[model samples]
Target chain A: MEEAKEGFEPKIIGFTCNWCTYAGADLAGTSRKKYPPNIRIIRLMCSGRLDPMFVLKVLLNGADGVFIGGCHPGECHYIKGNFYARRRIAALRTILKQFGLDDRVRSEWISASEGDKFARVMKEMAEDIKKLGPNPMRDKIL
Target chain B: MKGTELKQEDLEGLFKGLLDKKAVDCLVLPHKVGNNVAYMLVKDGDKIESPAASAIFAPSFGVNAANIVKGWTIPERVGIVAKPCEIRAAIELIKLKQMDKESVLLISADCSGAFTNQDYADHAGEIGDWVDSAKINELKGKGIAIREACAICENRLADVGDIIIERVDGGKVLVAGITDMGDEALSSTELSLEDKDVERQAEKEKIAADAKKEKEELPKMSSVEELEEFLRDCIACKNCRDMCPVCYCKECFFEQPLGKPVGGDLLNLAELRSAIGVPTNQLLYHLTRIYHVCTTCVGCGACEDACPKDIPLTRLYPLIAKKVQEIFEYVPGEDAEEPLPFITYEEEELEDKLR
Candidate 1:
């Protein structure tokens, strides 16, 4: 019943691979790119290490959205980490679709050199999540 | 392609011959225990008796026998007779390194569906007589139905087993060897083996098609609120995880210290959310479990049967598993050589699934 759409800032949990997205985020910050300061980044060695449970935990714990960033296909620093991550995130999204939360999570291939793309993705996700309103789980006692 | 047709009574002799000939050091099979039938490890040929050995063909299922045979590391070679689903679960376990494929022989049969444990125990006498006649259709006509999982089960025939027993028309049991080890074991028995074609594909397809239709007709949970509603009565006993044959973790993640919230953490969580469920993380527990098993789940419905609250879990897990499996074009327990979806991936695939 919270219909007030004035100045609602979505809280997003970003899981970024250290070799790619994490570096890209640092680059964005150094570049002073104007992206929403809504996301909290957790750097992992590889995207494959992002267990689906972690995303579920944060979402249920009241994070409004989740962002997953990894190396582009065939470009994982560990050879095939991003490939596995893609499969896992895809499967996770399929499960989330059943709960009407699929749109609340996003996965992208943002490399270390794509600071602009990384910042752009953050801004776009923040805007999209704002339009989606607060995550229903935010107020839920689940 | 060696097969032999024999009466139901002849099955006991064939199994006993395996023990007498030392084809197997032990036989893991279903036997009548007091009033209920349970899986037993029989070491001697004399221990294999009539009506008891026939319990394998009975429409009574208590647990997935794969759970019983998991982690068997003895030097003795064992032959395990089980339903098709149980065999499939065992195959998944073997692929997961939870069970050793070389250490045991997998014997599976054409399952004619099965009743839940309570139903089987209540009608054990009548069901026993019906099973002896090898007329499975008669039980349905008499208004005794199989469990929903069994009824919707498409993998009724064992395709991946080393040995397969087919119950054909006229109470005739046709035992065949599909693998090299299976042939060697069959050769030791006195029953003469000949080449025979098992033309059950059409029947199997029909059953699968019917099951698909039935599944499509069941109502689905489309949102988190609906899912929570469906699991409203769950007491968080974790029986479903315990009953699940593929949930083979030595220490489940939910049981770990990190998964448990202390009193202070609970208070903080309640304060943050303004309120919290008493059991706490009921949704998290089920979601994490379903996600964990989505890829490798055999859709055996053991979790549903284990639920004390009578939540229709079969409606959720198996259906979700079916969709997820379809996305990857992977069937759990179908092939040993196929890599697990989570462990292996292709460079250019599932593009539509990503943002």
Candidate 2:
């Protein structure tokens, strides 16, 4: 895969579970962490409600990468929400691989105390996606 | 208990006896209908003409007779002669509580395979003898291919509890009763079946091996743009969903399309993205339906046959369904006691699936 030109900025869609990941993002903002402003976050109450279709549609609609941040396994405020979401994301990744888009979609556990980790993940994801260049679907579907 | 074996000519008599002996009140099986073979519920003993020999099996992997009997709740037993896949679909429906299992007797005949409805009509018209088990190779030699789903079907034989009927050497119909009820049913008649378990087991192993090889060899859609191009010819017709035995929804979401505003969801999306395709929701409809049926699809390929666009949906669904179903270690219709994977999960399961 050819890398994008210098200064190419990746567009990422972040679906953050409000219980943990949303709080983590908020903590990062308050902490004035240095990270790329590539993600537009959508706050979901729980990761379980993160339907695979939503991730798929957003990716097909041309987002350079999709970032799903959820509560750590067995620590979901809603109990078992992240467990279910884990299974869905895993299944989703396999589907993504079939479409050669596996690298652009990832799930991470970012608790409220992991604000530093949240900022770091975004910066890393943005860099990787930038290297991958624009999503091919960006032209076909959008 | 031993059951007698009868010639191919006696299958009609066996059905007639089932009615006369009051074993079942109404029978659901394929019979001659105009020039085609279709499922019919028959109670009259006189109407039990042997199904066209070729037509009996040619309808397999296409029409799902299980869907025909899905809504039955009566106490009166109904005998259903269906392909093994249909029987499997029926078993899945039974576990879903979608069908009355106690009121039905599953009858499966020997299945070589079936062509699509149009192909079956053309092939049958050309050959003139509905389907002779011996001539199936000859039929294939004439440039007719079996439906894609049938090509990889592993469970072609009826399961242990089914009343399996097959034409063996010398044109003799071998009827086997594997359950107590099936044994009693056969005992009442003048037929018996010996155990051909070793042969059938070998055949099943070969089918499974072939399926594994085929899955590995499939050409997967490798890009979102390629996927969109593959699906671009869709005409928004819901025929595939309609023909799906597993899509047992009472009223589909598309059936009652909600009125849209001047600048609705599609417009909002288009404005955000700069462009969007019209006849919205085809991709959503297909993906949603696949998610819903992945564990219970039975790999029957009826949906593929119903596609008007000639989409190689059979190629798409079975491969994807295999991936999802493997995650659960579940094969739909393979077991009656097995709960659907989506609803039943162990606490320790799918641990590696997470981040």
Candidate 3:
């Protein structure tokens, strides 16, 4: 009985773009779609708008993982904003990895029509986060 | 440092002589902006005028002067008056290939310190009139003279300048040559160089010691949430960008047409906020800014000074810049020969990342 400890459940923070990912999540809800409930969605207007600091902030505050869902490249309502976001977050990921804190951060392309895709991504991300355990940023070593 | 023992008239006479002979194309000097003095380039033999003492210490003056002279392809050699930070910033700019230092002259004054605009307004008693070095020194002994950035800075003497006119040794300014260019300029002037290296070193140590104390006390937010909360007061004013000497982007990301407003859901509002004039990706903008210039940042404290909300943007940049520089073992402005991080990579050095 002592050897049988319960498995861990990861807390994932999803930053969803309002034009696509956020609408996808809303559609998933209205369609009564079933998905992992671990993801807590915070809707932003565009993926480009996410401050790389917010991900670090969320990770430090207690989220095990962060998911940034945005419109596909070239599909942004504001033209090249998502491209800029990609370039920015890509650099941020490199910087975090250099600091030994990159694995917990993830990004995906999702559209307003991709309700099922959103569900699958969330479920998979939750599993990966659970396997990865708590965010290393919480370790206080940095 | 609290009093002006030498009058501006004496300084003007010395500077006028240098300018008349075309000793330098311009003396990047100070002029009265209302009551306060900001940096202004005075061409050959022009009368120097100011209501108050200005910050000639900033390194941007060096860059601005260089940019003006070089960008315009002017044939004349220019002289610049700068603070220690300005000297450092200019040095960084040169290293980044953003500027060429061949035709510019640097003249740095003794830096007691500089006060924030607000500090000057609150303590100096009015903003409409010019506030100069004498007024600042009057408040120095009371621990209310300089800006927080100036207080925390370790460099008092302009390290990269050609000539340094410093007030040392019982208020007597000793003009000395820091480079060959300095020697050439001083060769023309009658100002004597006293062997006061010992005294100058002592002054330097005093500044370094004070800076060390402040540097140690700089807070690093333990949690991401705390950092966010600290930045929550950001009204998204681009004061930090405008005041940044190195943020020389022709057009910024936030100002571009591609930037979008954050979602209505995030604001917890009824509808999406309109996008015009609002900074859509505040964090991204800052990150991109730091990424572009992290190694070149001179920690001028101007960005923080310009912030209406007092977000301590300057404090954060230095911390991040230092980290980036250390990871790459790069000091931004130390020399011209050093290469930037993104421009070069070695297989042996990048093995960890590849694996």
Candidate 4:
């Protein structure tokens, strides 16, 4: 495995839904689960509220990676919010793939009860991103 | 379905008849304006007889006509004669409630492709009376070619219009009514209609296959650096957004004052990036615009035409739209009753696409 740079810790932006992933993240904290402290979380009411533009903005502004956590399929607090999110994110990923930034963005379905899963995903993502190095956009002016 | 075969010379009379018979209060068709063809709203029957009017079959494309008649609710039934792409855009707009379906009649024809406005203006006189049969290869032989978007457009013939006009051999055209409104309008014209099925399926399929080959051969961008280089000349004029028929937002987010940073905020952005590009947010603007219209873009190429930088936007937006539409199994403007992929979703679909 390629080792990360000597002191380069990846900067990740996490968008978590209030009803599920946010609470799950809270659970991870209260339970004292150990994970990397690289992510800055922004809570939204539902996954559907997350526009593809939000991901593009952070990535273009030099975010090393983006993590989107939503309710599991059929378990959305707003009926079909996560289902809609699935399609939007998939479409966004296709666009991202064209720019070779697809791997930098990840989406997952973590329920409020899955505190361990949340912590594990964060750890895994941090390790993968560290090896992948910083976002090329970080050096770009656009 | 019934149709009437009329000579090319008789088309003007037929259009005049529509207005004379009160089938439509006005006609939204291409008209000769100075040296270029432009969409005009003509209400007078005699105006159709003028030599300066009625260039419906001109090998010219300036703007998507759907944008011309958007939100038309004047209660005057307007008959819009348009190419397949414009018709498709109109269908999408109607579904989005941007247009009232009851107030307009869609008249589409098999497109033989068109030259950009600049190209047409430069070669209009040389291209005389051969638009209906101007094949791309043949035009190229004459030292001219159609726009890249038109050359590879698979939807050259639309099956969703209220009325369709098909050009046949022997200088004659077949006009068919695909809907009851079209049928009623045709019956009122007093032109005898007979059972005639337009059989250009083989021809359409050939064009489609050729288009598929062209699409596969298009240059692709696989990195942000490449994309930035490709858009290096962009001035952020937003002409592409302005010409876009589907970008119907009255107040675009990119144009909002809040989105434009100044003074301390601008300095902070520069500091965070170590440096910032002048005329900032070009990438953000384009990415957001593409994502916003990816679902509804009809690939009309108006944005490509309107671009002052000649950015080859058609190579990006339409190509991405094709992939995005395929993922959702949705074709924009294919059917008026079909819901947009963004507005509606199935309970169980695209599971593999999402991880």
For every model in order, what is the number of clashing pairs? 0, 7, 17, 0
For residues B1-355, what per-residue lDDT tens digits would candidate 2 score against the true structure? 3445677777788888877887778788776554456787889989877643444554434468888877677788888887888887888888877777678777777766567767766655654533443455576687776677876666666563357776567767667776666766666664445554425677668767866675566666877666667778887688888888888777875665431213576677778767766666676667656666777888888888889999988766766776777887888876577787766656566645543
Question: How does chain A of candidate 1 score by TM-score against the true chain A?
Answer: 0.95
By the DockQ metric, which is better: model 1 or model 2? 1
Candidate 1 lDDT over B1-355, as tens digits, reads 7889888878888889988998888888988765566788899989886764358877778888888877776667888898888888888888888767677788887776778778788888877733521344577688776776776777887666778888878878889998888888899876799997888888889879977876777787877889888989998889999999889888887777567676888788778878888787789999898898889888788888899999878877877887788889998877666788888877689878866
Q: Candidate 2 lDDT, tens digit per residue, A1-142?
A: 5776588788899999998999999989999998999999999999988988787778766788999999987789998888778777766766566667878987899999899999999988988898888888777643
Candidate 3 DockQ score? Answer: 0.05
TM-score-better candidate, 1 vs 2: 1
Which residues of candidate 1, in runs, are more than 4 Å off? A1-7, B33-36, B52-54, B124-145, B263-274
Each candidate's interface RMSD: 1.1, 2.5, 9.6, 1.3
What's each prediction's TM-score?
0.92, 0.85, 0.62, 0.93
Which residue window of length 10 is worst by lDDT in model 1 chain B? B128-137
| Candidate 1 local lDDT, A16-124, one digit each (tens) | 9999999999899889998999999998999989999999999888788899999989889999989989999999888888888888899999999999999999999
> Which should have the higher lDDT, number 1 or number 4?
4
Model 4: runs farther than 4 Å from truth?
A1-7, B49-54, B129-135, B141-143, B262-265, B271-274
Two-chain DockQ for each candidate model: 0.69, 0.44, 0.05, 0.68
Q: lDDT per model, in order?
A: 0.83, 0.74, 0.60, 0.84
Backbone clash pairs for candidate 4 read none
Candidates 3 and 4, the one with greater TM-score: 4
> TM-score order of candidates, best first?
4, 1, 2, 3
